[model samples]
Target chain A: DVKVTQSSRYLVKRTGEKVFLECVQDMDHENMFWYRQDPGLGLRLIYFSYDVKMKEKGDIPEGYSVSREKKERFSLILESASTNQTSMYLCASSLTGEGHNEQFFGPGTRLTVL
Target chain B: LAKTTQPISMDSYEGQEVNITCSHNNIATNDYITWYQQFPSQGPRFIIQGYKTKVTNEVASLFIPADRKSSTLSLPRVSLSDTAVYYCLVGAWEDTPLVFGKGTRLSVIA
Candidate 1:
């Protein structure tokens, strides 16, 4: 079985603070992603990494950045957290090949920006 | 990536079979239909995937017709634990970022 774990389950931060959310996968998958889930809006992609040091922006990546220094770890960084960034953060990883795009997701971290 | 449309919500009782249909009229030749289930505070979990015809697994079954324009997910003898949000996604596997819309909320009552 594949396991994806996040660094935190709940977090609270003040406005303009720098926040870091970490994700790790044991499957050594080549693809990892970050997404935010909000009520009514659904899940929106923030960023994704295909390989080490390789990153791509998703639909909503304006205030967020990602790091993939190693294959098992992917980190999401908020340059300066704002109240609007408060939401449930999810991380997923998948293998890169045909018919292998089934993503395994972590439990998710609910961040509250006050 | 092709667009998908499904119901907003559904209701079912325990021991009943539930089927949720999703429409993807613009699905491409290479696109595959996949479904995911998400709880209230957890990330979405992969349920099942299929191209055409019928595919069955331990948890659910996927039914797709010849046109491949739509798919249906069937859950047999559903229990209260089956209550969750079901998302139907259509896209090629190589597509970098998967898109998730407002999924159908299935409430299985006892």
Candidate 2:
């Protein structure tokens, strides 16, 4: 079984603060992703990393950035958190190539920017 | 990723079989259909995946017709725990992020 763990389950921060959400996967997957889920909007991708130090922007990557310094860890960074940035953040990891398959998601972190 | 369409919501009773269908008119030949289940306050979990015909797993079964334009997920003998949102995805076998549209919110009542 694959396991994905997040650094925080719930977080609260003031406006203009820098926020970091971390994710770690037990399996040695090559692909990692970050997403935000909002009511009525479903889940929207924020960023994804195919390999170490390799990142790509998703559809809604305007307000967020990502880091993949190591194989098992991926981090999401908010340069300046705003109230509109409050959302449930999700992390997922998957294998590449012929082993390419569905992602395994971690329990999301609900962040609130006050 | 091809666009998918499913119901907004569905209602079912306990011990009854639930079938949620998804339509993907522009699904490519190499694309496969996958389903994920998500409860409130949690990330989605993989349920099943299939390309053509029937594919069964321990938790659920996936049914795809010959045309490959649509697919159906079947859950046998549902319980209250089965109440969750089900998302249908269509994509090639590659390392791409799952594109989740408005999923079908299924409520399994007692």
Candidate 3:
């Protein structure tokens, strides 16, 4: 079984503070993704990394960035946390190639920016 | 990426089969249909995926017709634990950054 783990399950931060959400996968997948889930809006992609040091912006990438220094770890960084950034953050990893896009997700971290 | 439409919510009882259907009218040729289940406060879990016809797994089964415009997820003898939100997504094999819409919420009662 693929195991995806997150550094925190819940977090609270004040406005304009810097926040980091870490994700690690044991399957050594080549693709890692960060998403935020909000009520009524569903899940929106924030950022994704295809390989080490390679990152791409998704639909909702404002105020957020990502780091993939190693194959097993991916981190999401908020430059300046705001109240609007409060959401349930999710991390997923998947193998690259055909018929291999099935992403394994970690338990999300619910971040509250006050 | 193809847009998917599913029921907002459903109700079922234990020991009964639950079939949730999703519609993707604009599904492309290379696109595949995948289903996910998400419990409260947890990330979504992959359930099944299929291009056409029937594909069965240990947890659920996916049935897609020839037109590929829609798919049905069949959960046999559902239990209370099966209660969760089911999301249906359609995308190409190499499409990065998946898009998930508001999923169907299934509430199973005892």
Instruction: Indicate which candidate wins on lDDT.
Output: 1
lDDT accuracy of residue B90 in candidate 2: 94
The true-versus-predicted C-alpha distance at residue B60 of model 3, in Å, is 1.2
What TM-score do all the candidates reach, one by one? Answer: 0.98, 0.98, 0.96
**Residue A15 CA error for candidate 3 (Å)?**
0.9
Across A1-114, the per-residue lDDT of candidate 2 in tens digits comes to 999999999999999999999999999999999999998888899999999999999989988999999999999999999999999999999998863778999999999999
lDDT score for residue B27 of model 2: 96
Where is model 3 chain B poorest over a 10-residue stretch in terms of lDDT? Answer: B92-101
Ten contiguous residues with the weakest lDDT in model 1 chain A: A37-46
> Whose TM-score is higher: candidate 2's or candidate 3's?
2
- lDDT string for model 3 (A9-109, tens) is 99999999999999999998999999999987778889999999999999889999889999999999999999999999999999999989998999999
lDDT of 3 by residue, B40-103 (tens): 9999998999999999999999999999999999999999999999999999889875688889
Clashes of 3: 0
Candidate 3, residue B77: the lDDT equals 100
- Chain A TM-scores, per candidate, are 0.99, 0.97, 0.98
